[model samples]
Target: MRVVKAPDVRRSEILAAANQLFQTQGYSRTSVDQIVNKVRIAKGTFYHYFKSKEQILDALADQLVLDMAYHSEQIANHTQLNAIEKIVTIISEQNRLQSEQQNVVDSMHLPDNRQLHERINIKIVLTFGPILATVIEQGNQQGLFDVKDPLSTIQFILAGSLFLFGEGVFNWPPEQAQARIQSMIILIERTFGAQPGSMIIALNQCLNEEKR
Candidate 1:
């Protein structure tokens, strides 16, 4: 018997199956047939939800950004933390999640996945920019920041960070990458007129905890 499911439920299953295949076998190696087989769905059913494998990848990217945005928003709205603390906590949580899903990250960096990879970066900028900007705005109002335009400033910062750290785009040596990370911390502090080392100390403390 053909099992029927809601459109959204079926689509989620397709994406979930595709994500697993992509993680284990990589994007180029995983095809439409493999995804359909995993979900036990017909080719027509797959096509009904997604026009092409590329389109599916785009949807997956959007989902990834949405998940990240949800977590960041939760941190942004926390009454206990100030803006700086919110920023640090959000970043720390994101890094921890990414580290746990290293396979997904590695899959996105695979051959023929550049477009998918780039799409995710752009989506992150669009989705996360607004959320982080709200935090910055809160900081600005509290006299903890001096940003002239919260949205634009955060979008610029996010775009730069994504591209710079995006693995396939730039293969920086560990030392160079660390240097850039430190420089970025300083740049953010200066841009927001934060007291020197304030952001650095907080961010490093979070990062150190991750290492332990």
Candidate 2:
């Protein structure tokens, strides 16, 4: 007897196959036929789940944001770590993922990919802001942060950190990037009323670990 897969399960299988192909073959080189062939699904089935290759890319971007949020939430939920530690862990994880996926990052630097890159960034901030805000709210309760609005504060931080320091934007020198990072830390600390230099220490520690 053969079994039937649920719609959502089938959709995820398609996404999984597409993600693997996109990572291995490059997104622009991968096609609908390849994705369906990998999954042994009909072309029509792929269209049922996604209208086009671009739509699959959009879904992949959404998955990336959700995966990041899920990991950040896990750090935020850790009982032993304070709010600052959770934030640091989240940042560190993000940096680690970025390093691991440098190919994906570099693809976004292509001139033709600018629109898709911008769309992905918007999706990331929309999905990630609330998760970060939860951490900020916890900080407020613990008296580590004194911001009146966690959501808005997170949005502002993400705008600068995501767009300004993000790849393919300013193309800053190493020294300039470091300076901007330091300034961002200071801005975040001051805006939320966190202790001076604490965020800097955390960021430095994360960067140091990335070297090893």
Candidate 3:
């Protein structure tokens, strides 16, 4: 008897196969046939779910962004956490996800993948901006943050961080990079009207926990 998988399950299988191939063989060299073969699926089956190889790449990026957004939204909705705690939780989860996907991140940074890299960055901002904005707005209402526009502020922070910290955008020496990161953190605190060291301290604790 032939087995028929559910649509979502089958699509996930295809994506998992493509992700592995992309990681091991590089996206530029991975073909649709390779992905289908890896998943033991027909070319028609792959095309049924995704229009093109580029779309598969986009789907992969969507999955990553959605995963991060889900985590952020969950934290944002938690009634027990204040705005600062929510922000710290969201960042910590985002960092953990990014670190887990570091290889994929590095692959996207390759010069040939610049277009896809840019698309992924935009997707992140679009998906996460609103989720983050709500948290910031909550902060504003609670007097934890003073922002005229929460969504705009979040988008700006996301875009600037992506640009400044994106791989190959700038190559700074170790000390310079550290200084710039410090400056960015301080700027973020000021932007939110947060206490001078509160965000810095919270972020440092988050990072230290990640390291452990």
Candidate 4:
């Protein structure tokens, strides 16, 4: 009988190594040979787990979107915060996640895997819908926000916040990324028909001193 180890554990280890290597070098520069060598796995074993380097990078993107979902869920659980406060929380959380993903992307050429990138982008956008729905429901119930279509509104906000990252259209200074995100949050809040002053104040309080 063969002893069995958890597939996910081994896969997670492989992905961790890939992330590290891909960051230091780059995605395009990272070959499967190096990854298996670094992971101390045989070439056959590597194929057993992943079909190609693109698959691995796709896995990386999927992991990030899952992480974003996890973090946003955590923020949603902070019921102590009000609806507006939750918007701020959501903004900071997504921006924080984007920065980390960008660092990983910087070390890799993920755009070459355009399909995977688009899939992961959809994953992130889909993950955000629930939280926004909750906020929209709460705000409308409280008469603090007006919305005709919660789903469409959520989609718009998600697109506005993350469109640039998905398309690689915008890049901001490291010191200013948070600020730019906050600015987008302000735009989203206003577009959703929330009072900018209270929402902005709430968002500013959520950001670190440096970001504010």
* Candidate 4 Cα misplacement greater than 4 A, ranges: 1-4, 107-110, 164-167, 170-187, 201-212
- Superposed on all Cα atoms, the candidates' RMSDs to the truth, in angstroms, are 2.6, 3.0, 2.9, 4.1
As for candidate 4, its clashing pairs are: 26-107, 27-108
Per-prediction TM-score, please?
A: 0.87, 0.83, 0.85, 0.77
* Clash count, one per candidate: 0, 0, 0, 2
Question: Over 4 Å off in model 2, which ranges?
Answer: 1-4, 97-109, 205-212
Tens-place lDDT digits, model 2, residues 1-212:
53468999999999889878878878779889999899998898889889988777767766666777788878878889878998899989877776665446556656777887888788777877888898899899999999899998898888767777666778788888777777777888899899887677887777545433
Residue-by-residue lDDT tens digits, candidate 1, 41-133: 999999999999878777776676677788999999999999999999998888776665555666667667787888788888888899999
After superposing candidate 3 on the true structure, give the runs of residues whose Cα lies further than 4 Å from its correct spot: 21-34, 51-54, 204-212
Q: lDDT score of model 2?
A: 0.79
TM-score of 2: 0.83
User: Which candidate gets the maximum TM-score versus the true structure?
Assistant: 1
Question: Residue 81 CA error for candidate 3 (Å)?
Answer: 1.2
Cα error, candidate 4, residue 142 (Å)? 3.5
The local distance difference test score of each candidate is 0.84, 0.79, 0.84, 0.70
- lDDT, candidate 3, at 111: 87
Would you list the clashing residue pairs of candidate 3?
A: none
